[model samples]
Target: MAIDWIGFSYAATLALGGVLGYTRKGSIVSLIAGLFFGALAGYGAYCVTCDPRDVKISLYAAFILATVMGIRYRRSRKLMPAGMIAFLSVVMILRLILSLL
Candidate 1:
């Protein structure tokens, strides 16, 4: 199978979210659950798109996740968890918008 950069990046983003969640909450369960869901969603999105053209769903999810994380970070005053998610979410949103154009 061909390698999908976007998919890989998405997966990485999910894994990062898990890491950040663990660091912020000190809950291994959060990390594992996040990774599991993220990986699943990333792989699913990757397969569904087969390219950058169909990034809407992924983009929407990314945007939402980012927004939520940003808010979470603001409230908790934590940098790593929320910051990382927000950052990646922004990147994904940008990519999605670009893909649309």
Candidate 2:
């Protein structure tokens, strides 16, 4: 099987998002869920494109989505969660690296 870097990064973000969703109020959980679903949709969109194109497409989508989520979470004072930042950080960084390669 091929080592799908974008898929791995996407899956990792999802896994970490589950942990980051933890919150007593549950809103953070909801936000992470939103982010997760949004990412999933974007990733699905990326998959429909052809092979070599899919790589850059997925990475760009991933980068944009993660960046937006991070910015949104940071600006919305009420939505910031403990682990979401880390999840975004990892996903964004990985996406950038993969996009470069």
Candidate 3:
């Protein structure tokens, strides 16, 4: 069941890419990043859930990674402008759930 997320991730990314291209005037890369961000968010959430006290470090790491990716690719089309915020939010939320575990 949990493993199904991988397939869902790919499909969702492709679907979002198509939607953005057709409606939001976004490029395929945006969709790809959105999907990638979502997956990253999920992974981050998973990580912090394993250790709540380490959330600060995990979050900082994620931010650094995001910054690096942004610097490496100047094209906004390859990334969702605010996806990092969304990704962080989701990761935090997931971490909260993991904390209760």
Query: Highest TM-score: which candidate?
Result: 1
- Candidate 1 residue 3 C-alpha distance from true site, Å: 4.5
The alpha-carbon deviation from the true structure for residue 55 of candidate 3, after best TM-score superposition, in angstroms, is 4.0
TM-scores for all candidates?
0.71, 0.42, 0.39
Q: TM-score for candidate 1, please give it.
A: 0.71
Q: What tens digits encode model 1's per-residue C-alpha lDDT throughout 1-101?
A: 44557756777768777777699879897699578758765864786467656665676677677888899888988776677777877887787677568
lDDT of each: 0.72, 0.54, 0.48
Sort order, lDDT high to low: 1, 2, 3
lDDT of 3: 0.48
Instruction: Judging by lDDT against the true structure, name the best candidate.
Output: 1
Return whichever of 1 and 2 wins on lDDT: 1
- Comparing 2 and 3 on TM-score, the stronger one: 2
lDDT for each residue of candidate 2 in 1-101, tens digit (9 for 90 to 100): 33555564555555455555554445576557646755663464446333433555455555655676667766774455433643555565575466547
Compute the lDDT of residue 7 as modeled in candidate 1. 55
Point out the higher-scoring one by TM-score: 1 or 3: 1
Candidate 1 stretches with Cα past 4 Å from truth are 1-3, 16-29
